[model samples]
Target: MLDEAEDDRDAAAPIDMLERYFAAHGWSHQRDEDEIVAKVKGSWTEFELRAIWRADDGVLQFLAFPDVRVADDRRGAIYEAIGLINEQLWIGHFELWSSSGILLFRHAAMIDVEEAALSLEQAEVLVDTAIDECERFYPVFQFVLWGGKSPREAIAASMIETRGEA
Candidate 1:
């Protein structure tokens, strides 16, 4: 059994590890209380990666926001695309903030007390997964929003696997 001081230290360990991870990668980040926000440039676009550590619940919620906005008229199509995209994802899910019409990817992991700390590799994987998924599916959203393609069509186009470069 650990005392309050030890418990508190354990709770903050993940965030501190994340801070170090971000700094090592040369990603610009800001830490506020239990949250850290970092700016990362993905292949498709820029992304804002945010992580919030919940001390009481020992949960770490990670989010990646792609710099894309959906128009009011395209919400229905975007929502459909999100469903299709999320279906194929194993770790996280994509969500559109209805009020702001912004698209973001979100995932959460539980850090057990026994574990007590988040490893740097785990932090790297979390961030990489978010950005990779965002980059992979960004054009699908673009196809639906600006190219006037159906959700299925957009997904199909995005799924085309390219071979070795010419």
Candidate 2:
């Protein structure tokens, strides 16, 4: 009975649920303490997703880092692009790590400690949303970084919606 209680407690941990979700999807991941790092491949690029569960605070902070870097010359434009991009997102936001010029999408969800567990569907949606946002905005960053386009131009170019195949 004691062991069963312990099992239930372990199952309720957010990090453990996230780990199981990653494994079920066959994504490469490693868990250390209260964090799980996984590599997810998106249409535009691959991303490194790091989810940290703070049980004390009952917050799950998830960050998805795309395999793109901002150049010193393009930092200003990139920052502007991020601002515009973030405005369109209903959930999560883009961040540029100034020190490293690394770009990432970050979101945090508050979980009720009493409940303690997130449904597998919730976990999937959390991860999918991050990846979807990254893929959606990747080309905007690329246009600014490599194409030397202005922030407005980059946003416009990336926002074009095509209905069917050419």
Candidate 3:
């Protein structure tokens, strides 16, 4: 959701900031140049090792990811991404019930998530985070009620019966 005008014109990429941040504390973010990959519940996530030689100063860190779509049945993917954000933020974990699509995430840790060409880890975490937060804030469950009828016909009948000649 971030734009070119944002980011204060003087901030490192969210990921790079994490590295520089740790470095100031004498912590080292060491990782193989190659990518670290993993899959959770059939959703693929990739990461690389970035270590801290010293404890972080609790400075605000940003993380971003571009657009990604998740299906309804794969709600667990949302929780998995939440765990990753918790790890990065050093915060309590969260639970989610992802329910929407086409999330436009802005003001995410001061990072423009949608604008970021995020890595797999970033993509997974962000896609899930946005979905989870939206669902938590606006919980809506919609389904068709059937009475031995096709869903389409059931919907029509229900609407007609409830309208009461309107």
Candidate 4:
């Protein structure tokens, strides 16, 4: 019984570390049960982050949803474009919540109490990766939804390399 209780605390230690990290970073966040909801300001769009500690799986997962929501008519194109973009990504991937037509970036990292002390830093890396991937591909989403561009065209337009610094 005592061992079981200790295991429960160990499982929750990562979440506790994440919550403290959010507070220390001055991010306005609310904790609800086992999840933390916060807002992240990105270069291309404002993103809402939902982080949940799934004790059953012993992993911390994060979902970053941008301000833009896809329309029903554009879902297919957006989905195709996400597939292309996700291929280029090293970690995390874009996904559309079909029922709601909400697109988001998702990623997860495994955790244990031994690494709980570094949870705060690891969480930051996960958050940064999610935000960077979303911001990088945000233009493709806009092109497909508003510009009426094909998936390939949108990806090409967004991938154009800059020649020189500003």
Candidate 5:
């Protein structure tokens, strides 16, 4: 539900399911903190991060945190093309965690794509794909997922973060 350029130190003011899920488990060590801009209030163990990169070679990288996956805009134009294409779809913010409530992945997904479980490994691929996708559209797009095993613990942490959000 959060864009690739948005960052929240606290949990987003939405998604009751996420809040309830977290309370049910009880894993609130870090309130969604990462290396980025803007932190919201009442964050659990996960935070949403988003950023856009423009390279001198006419390349654009749209990256989102906590997953920190990079999407290569290798289609037409990274910003102009991907931004235009993304405008057509309805996006929503989604967070996923492990069974123990560790942050795994957080990003904007198409209305249809965000409603599912994604493992850490799969999330890694997603990051790779995002980077490659960005490269495809533009010329470059790379991302880094700060903090611990966010990529590996994404699915497990998401399960917990979702509960925390509840």
Candidate 6:
């Protein structure tokens, strides 16, 4: 029984598992041998999330591009707000692609075990957390990008909590 189970585990690929997980959640996704791409809609924005599985490193990375490129003039403010926003994230953080001025969120996990050993729930969390973090901080980026707000002000604006309906 042990040998059979191990064989089964070995037969399942991580990419396949992730593809199935994305399907199970009713998400539209595309996958090749190395990566899977999905579009996730957050409260503030719609973003494309890419999950790349590195066989050699046993690491899988989920990245979400918020579709907002920080303009050259505003990169400074956005960069500062990203620093503040990153401090609040528990699982993933934001990053700026310097060359392209693109802002994205990234979350990664190391699954040293066989691909079959990872459950759909585990994969879901990775995507969910990445999307959630992006949703949470997108407003901060917008505040800095569009509102001409200072980094501290943007962070503060994004952090406001509402208690009840007015």
Q: Against the true structure, whose lDDT is highest?
A: 1
Q: How does residue 132 of candidate 2 score in lDDT?
A: 90
Backbone clash count, each prediction separately: 0, 0, 4, 0, 57, 0
Candidate 6 lDDT tens digits, 2-71: 2234443343466776777667667789999988898766678778989888888888887889889977
lDDT of 2 by residue, 1-166 (tens): 1223434335456788788778767889999989999998888888999999988888999999999988898889998999988889999999999899999999988999888777665677789899999998999999999998998999999999999888
Query: Over 4 Å off in model 2, which ranges?
Result: 1-11
* Total clashing pairs in model 4: 0
Q: Write the per-residue lDDT of candidate 3 for residues 15-121, one digit (tens) a residue.
A: 44434333433433453222211111212222222211111332222222223344564444444444443444332233342455422222223234444322334
- The superposed Cα distance between candidate 1 and the true structure at residue 35, in angstroms, equals 0.2
- Residue 87: error of model 1 in Å? 0.8
C-alpha lDDT (0 to 100) for residue 73 of candidate 5: 23
List runs of model 4 lying over 4 Å from the truth. 1-12, 113-118
Q: Considering TM-score, which of the candidate structures 1 and 3 is the better prediction for this target?
A: 1
Query: After superposing candidate 3, which stretches have Cα over 4 Å from the reference?
Result: 1-9, 32-91, 94-110, 114-166
C-alpha lDDT score of every prediction, in listed order: 0.87, 0.86, 0.32, 0.79, 0.28, 0.78
TM-score ranking, best first? 2, 1, 6, 4, 5, 3
Clashing pairs in 1: none
User: Can you write out model 1's per-residue Cα lDDT over 21-76, one digit (the tens) per residue?
Assistant: 67767889999978999998888898999999988888989999999999899999
lDDT of 2: 0.86
At residue 8, give the lDDT of candidate 2.
Answer: 36
